[model samples]
Target: MLQGKNIHFCISERPIIGEVNIMVAPGELTAIIGPNGAGKSTLFKLLSGDLTCNRGEVSYNGKPLAGFKSNQLAKVRAVMPQHSEVSFPFSSWEIVALGMINDPAAISDRDIQAVMEKLQVWHLRAQAYNMLSGGEKQRVQLARVLVQVWKKQAFPRFILLDEPVSSMDVALQHLVLDFMNELKQRNIGILMVLHDLSLVANYADQVIMMKHGEVMANGHVSEVFTNQNLESLYGYPIHVEKHHEGLGLLVHSLPIHHINQRINKAL
Candidate 1:
């Protein structure tokens, strides 16, 4: 339902997110993967309407993005910013419930509670948001964002996430991605900026690779995360080796002998 057509965004006449075209099917989890400063965040902002694109158009269904009012947009799309520090001291439950507040339709406290439970932040419901650990705060914020768009059913809602798992631990990282995968299975459109190549390979149905504000590759995960694209993404050598359960893991460009030598030297 979300679509961007030849979208371009520039800062001071220098393009940041170059002309891009994307269509997110109803039940798809698409990952925007690229090296640091490749404008992945910039592209997401444009799609979320936080920043206007210099050219091209982003639309939802048959309606133009620019046509939606702020509240209207809020009901349709929710964005989780990259780095948010809880400057204001509020209860965790209060922060999470804020997501459903803006929603015009009345939502029950029970529904909000359910969302919090699913995010595993129910135990933190009464804690001060500002005082929570980074990962806790991230989970609370994520729960809030989800409640904002969740509604009674998962319609007219799309989530735009920027590095939601960056602060999370390894197990939590998989939990977050697995939750996102479940969202896609439930017909939710998730557009996320993720740095984990292995996770992307396992979970992402669509992958958009960027390099220096340009699209290096965009398509199915397997097609986009090839050895060449991974190398280009990091400006170095990389190899995709067969991995667990028919998956692929990206390895460094160094030869096996050199890898062993380095490991032996370290040992």
Candidate 2:
């Protein structure tokens, strides 16, 4: 499991994250959701070892994050940031192959092809990475990260993604979430920062709600996703309804007039 205890981060005396504690177990999908400047991405950076915490401990399977070497960490955890820029003229196939650079012999062309096929990007394998559309490029980047930790190991593994589906259309968004669900079945813990509350309601096994660098709520989706909590976190009125088919919860925002009407009724 990947765990963080009392994580705190600050920049020039301005706190960006404070007393954040989280746990991600294998075979689960944990989502971080909040309004802008809520420190969701900053928390991700701290968890991914990109930034050092001011006061806290981050561990992977009981070992401190600082103790792991770069290559050693690569074997167990893969991170896909919000933006990836590839200025070089590398083909999509080559970009995905780069994921296995640490242990090239452990992965083969067949492995790469399988991942590409699964992501439905096999047809674009020969195309240039820079030439692909925004959504296609995102898929390629995801494929690269997936290839890194594809093979199961004795220890737990994880994938940290930041706004991974922001560029995709509705259909592609579901497709990507479905792929993530498949990964969870393989015992890979996934920690993603998502802006879409409805998607969070559907796919997240656990939810962490943050505002102004502190955790407002954290628990199973059903417990933490109440309409009251969402309104407090977003500073606006939100309505949540259960799906008729029992797939998941559907969330909606109340317009200003509707919010005023509700407030008048309460008064």
Candidate 3:
């Protein structure tokens, strides 16, 4: 489990990530949702140990994150960030293999192969990673993270994905989230930053909504995703509707009351 106690971040003089206590356990898919500037990405970075919080303790399974070496932390929580490449001519297979290069544990080529196969990127193994489309590249990256945390069934695992589905098309979004849920079934905890409320409604077991560096709501999917929550978070009157797959959100545009307030204030 990854947890933060009074976690906070600062950029120059501004507090970009407000302090909060969060506990993420294993075997559940957690979604971090909010509008722009809500500190979702910043919080993800802090939890991934990419950035140090000014005042807080980020512990994993009762051990201080600071106590773990870079490789040790990498082994426990595999993080997939948003950016694509510094330079990329590496084959899809090679890119994933790189994930195992600096590992503290001994992982054979067979392990890397298995991760790619699990992600269904094995056929593209020989293809140059850059040659693939945006979504394909994203999947390859995801496969890389899978390899990073890819341990035999005995050990625990956690996967952190930041906007992984943004590059994917609609159908593929479902595919990716479905795979994420399957990972949870495999006892892999997933902490993902998702922008789509509908996906959060349908797929996530829990939701953590943030705004302007503060957490607005955090609870189970059914409890956290509500019409009132959406309106408060995004300043719009959004509603969730049921679909065959699960829940779907139909945002009927911004509220007339909000528009009226803006008009009256402008007057």
Candidate 4:
């Protein structure tokens, strides 16, 4: 498991993320959801060790994140930031291959091909990464992260992603998330920043809702995704209803004007 205890971060004496505690356990898909400026990405960086916190601790399994050497950490966790740029003319295949740079020999060409094909980017393998469409590039980057933790290890490993499907169409979004479900079977923990509440409602095993750098709610989706919790988190009149299609839930928000009329009547 990956855990953070009372994690805090600041800039110029102003806290960006403050006293946040979280746990990502193996075999679960944990999602962090919030409106804009909620410090979701900042918290993600702290957990990924991209940015050191001013106070508190982040650990993988039981070891402090700081204690792990670069190579060792690579084996335990793979991260996909919200934005990644490849200025050079690297081919899609080459970009994915970089994931195994620590020890390329560990993963074979066949395994690499399988990953690329699975992501529907095998045909784009020879194409320059910079030339691909936004959704295509996203898939390629995801494939890279997959390659890093492709082989199963004896201990738990993790993948940290931020707004992973923001650029994709609805079909692609479902495709990518479905594959994430498959990863859970391999005992790999997936922690991602998600903006789509519908996706969070349908797919996540656990959810963390944040606002103004604080955790508004966190727990199993069924608990944290209530109408009241969501309305408070988003500061809007939202509804959480049972999905007629299946066991999942459907979340929607009323128009601001409509909510104001109801509030006025109550007052």
TM-score against truth, every candidate: 0.89, 0.95, 0.88, 0.95
Lowest summed lDDT over 10 consecutive residues: which window, candidate 4? 245-254
Candidate number with the higher TM-score (2 or 3): 2
Off by over 4 Å in 4: 257-267
Candidate 2 residue lDDT tens string, 148-260: 98886778899999999888889989988998888987779999999999999999999999999999999999998998999999988788999889767899886888878
Q: Which residue runs of candidate 3 sit more than 4 Å off their true CA positions? A: 86-88, 104-111, 153-155, 244-267
| CA lDDT of each prediction against the hidden true structure | 0.82, 0.92, 0.82, 0.92
Residues 85-113, model 3: lDDT tens digits: 83957899889887776673657788777
Query: Order the candidates by TM-score, highest first — what do you get?
Result: 4, 2, 1, 3
lDDT of 2: 0.92
Q: Tell me the RMSD of model 2 versus the true structure.
A: 1.8
Any residue pairs clashing in model 4, and if so which?
none
Q: Which digits, one per residue and each the tens of the lDDT, describe model 1 over residues 1-267?
A: 899999988889888977788877767888998888999888888888988888999997658898999888887788999877766788999998888767636567897888788778899999999888888889899998888866545464679999888888989888888888666655678988988777787788898888888888889986777888898788766777767566555444677788789889999
After the best TM-score superposition of candidate 2, give how far the Cα of residue 147 lies from its true spot, in angstroms.
0.3
